[model samples]
Target: MRVVSLHSPAKVSGISTAGARLSRLPPPHEPWTPLLIGRALTDEIVRDTPLHDAPGLALCAWPADMSPVGQVLLVRERLRELGARVVIPNDLYHGFVAAALDHHRGVRVGAWLHAEHHDGDELFERCAPISDAWRCVSERGLARALRVGAGLDIPPAGEICPACVEVPPACAAPSVDGPLRLVYAGRLEKHVKRVMDLALLADELDARGVSFTLWVAGDGPARLDLARAMDTHIRAGRVSLLGPVAQHDMPALLTSADTLVLVSLSEGMPTTVMEAFACGRIACVTAGCGGAVPLIEHSGVGVVVPTGDMRAMAAHLARFAADR
Candidate 1:
């Protein structure tokens, strides 16, 4: 039941969050190990991981000093030594390596995919065929996997696994009120998130004389654009950029708001929708938000509009304002 996940050096930041998620699941008969590429794991990482000092199971990190092919070979050999039954890789190249390990040795290979647009196009075409199965985190991702005819079921990794969830059935009824409390809790990026749509929506709401507060939470390369686009609103006290909320503090931010607004151009199932639904907040999302449309339709947890449709977005905002 031993499983090893391959991760790049840049994957360290999510270590604690991943560890927290893993700790919530039932541990397998054998300990699950996360195989990361690094010279050494920081004390902070070890301290955050639940199984850091587990009796039999421990963390594993290898040095980053080999060619891509050489590293793959090393990882393959190491997995053999550790008696690892399964390998999970995040990207195509690594998935190819996992497939190689499966072909060379008797190892199960699966991919952890989270994006729909990427998964639908190049990613699935390149990686899904090579891997035995996809541990898709979103319904859209799963459909894309099915489109490529990759296996749908996640291998029973026993312990090492990604958290895959379908559209939840129930949602908390929204407070739905005057001066609607709207919030956007994700990257303020122009490319993927289309944060500009939000700014436009704000302008439309403002022009229509809607009394509302739209809090933009999160920071990224497009923060300046967002600030520029909504400067007047920020000064007018209609929008406020919270700037990089820690994951733990998200619940408070979500709960305080009446609805979560996301006008993303493309996405997997965003957790903001789930968080909003759990807090009795409807998620007003874009069609580009992958599986969110289905979730919104089925669960009544949110509303979905087409990507980059400012008029439609404004209409929804107006409707919400009217309802409130």
Candidate 2:
């Protein structure tokens, strides 16, 4: 028996890393035959691939970005070639495991949804027919997934170990003279992360006499538009675009930051927010943002605001800066 976790290389940055942190296992003392089909998993490319002696526990990850059907079928065939029966695929962000489910209906499939979805976007529901079990990263997300009339697995958020997270040193409270160091990491896609909103919020903060410098990490097609939105701030040394910092380098950048801010339209349990908490920095996140809401609320690690309310966010940041 082997465990094969499948995911796309495209997801290596944001989603895959979070999933790995939640479910990755340690390597065994004995050597085993770990099959390789495509690029390695995001976080632990070598050590934590989950090819244990117990096939049920082995994690085989593959990507389904460009051609979902082809990739899914390829994974199914690969698993069959290896004589594996049970395969668990994380179906949170990508939604590409259905083709694999279709071809391998007899296999015990463990599927999961990473966040709450639209009524029309029943991702977990679509795969339920072929799945042996269903789970979610957060209980709230699981409840919402079940509301769509689908069986969802609700696990404790603490199941993800904090010690497993790799982060930088904790940041200290800001002083009156020092500008507030803000950060927005992860993919720059506008659909989910809504990064353009950060540019607008920067302008508002500057107008309100808030001294702050925002450092945006990661890259995407929206890079040009984000630059256009922050034209003034960029010139005035208020916003810096640290294009695509390697995952290993993220800890240093995040540790220097006073606050980790994400104003996404939607979110799952954002690893970046948890990354901030691990680094002992504050998180100013949007309210009702899937799994991240509870992490921030329960830990008292940061503040939560209404989605799209730039004014309230700016006020909150300004007040936070003043109090510090």
Candidate 3:
């Protein structure tokens, strides 16, 4: 079967990384293709390697100003050209396009929930009616879908398709001798990710006299502002901004850090936490980080603090640092 997975640009974010991995790891008998929309990144790791060489993947740059109807038509034509029998839209824009294609006799559409927040609710309401199936990145996301389905009078049928990562044979344990090494890998955005809170967390940690080093990987609109906010830390070598590390390099990055930190205001299921687990590293996340909270709590993988509570996060990290 030919499957087309539609997603946003092939950037250094979780969705883009997951889409790239899916393109390369399809069933032997099924030719799964990732139809990435928008301009491609020129990053050495992202644009030059896996995405370019991955089999059955197609990259296309569409005009950003294209009308919604036009985008849908373009996607429909692309699907026909690719002979895609199954369409999975990983984002809301492509979800709408996939929903429109549900009328096609030979094609099946699946609505994917990547978050458990307001946007997830919106996606299900707008696309679930026409979607032949529902898929979510985490159990929390799947539950959210069922709840939304109940409200929308849609059937309760969806599967949890958690984010994936290739586990290495062995990962080096975090060193017990130096300053606590923490890494945050994701888009530096304020709204959902609340990346600005990192600045606050740094301040709290400094106030507590916690010895630590934070490495932030990934870039977004808030990058400049976050850099400004952490200027003192950056100058003091307490924080470093490693912009947009590639998916392939993530395991090494995670293995190097004692703990992966995510202080997002909200999340569906962060792929970084899964990668951290695969690399034998724990996580310190906010309670708003959907599925990650329960996973951390149940597994004792790391710590979970209330949303926006930098003081609590600082306290937990301080304990880890002191204990280590």
Model 2, position 151, has a per-residue lDDT of 45
lDDT of each: 0.65, 0.64, 0.79
Please say which candidate is ahead in TM-score: 1 or 3: 3
Q: In candidate 1, which residue pairs clash?
A: none
Clashing pairs in 3: 218-244
Name the lDDT value of residue 72 in candidate 2.
51
TM-score for each predicted model, relative to the true structure:
0.73, 0.76, 0.92
Q: Please give the distance, in angstroms, between residue 286's alpha carbon in candidate 3 and its true position after superposition.
A: 0.2
Worst window of 10 by summed lDDT in candidate 1: 157-166
Clash statistics: count for each candidate: 0, 15, 1
Tens-digit lDDT track of model 1 for 119-206? 3456656665556666766666666666665443333222223342223344444455657888897766788878888888998888
Which is better, 1 or 3, measured by lDDT? 3
lDDT of 3 at 144: 72
Candidate 1: C-alpha RMSD to true structure equals 5.7
Query: Across residues 161-215, which tens digit of lDDT does each residue of candidate 3 receive?
Result: 7766789889997989788899999988999999999999999999999888999
- Give the best candidate by TM-score: 3
Give the per-residue Cα lDDT of candidate 3 at 221. 85
Ranking by TM-score: 3, 2, 1
Which predicted model would earn the best lDDT? 3
lDDT of 1: 0.65
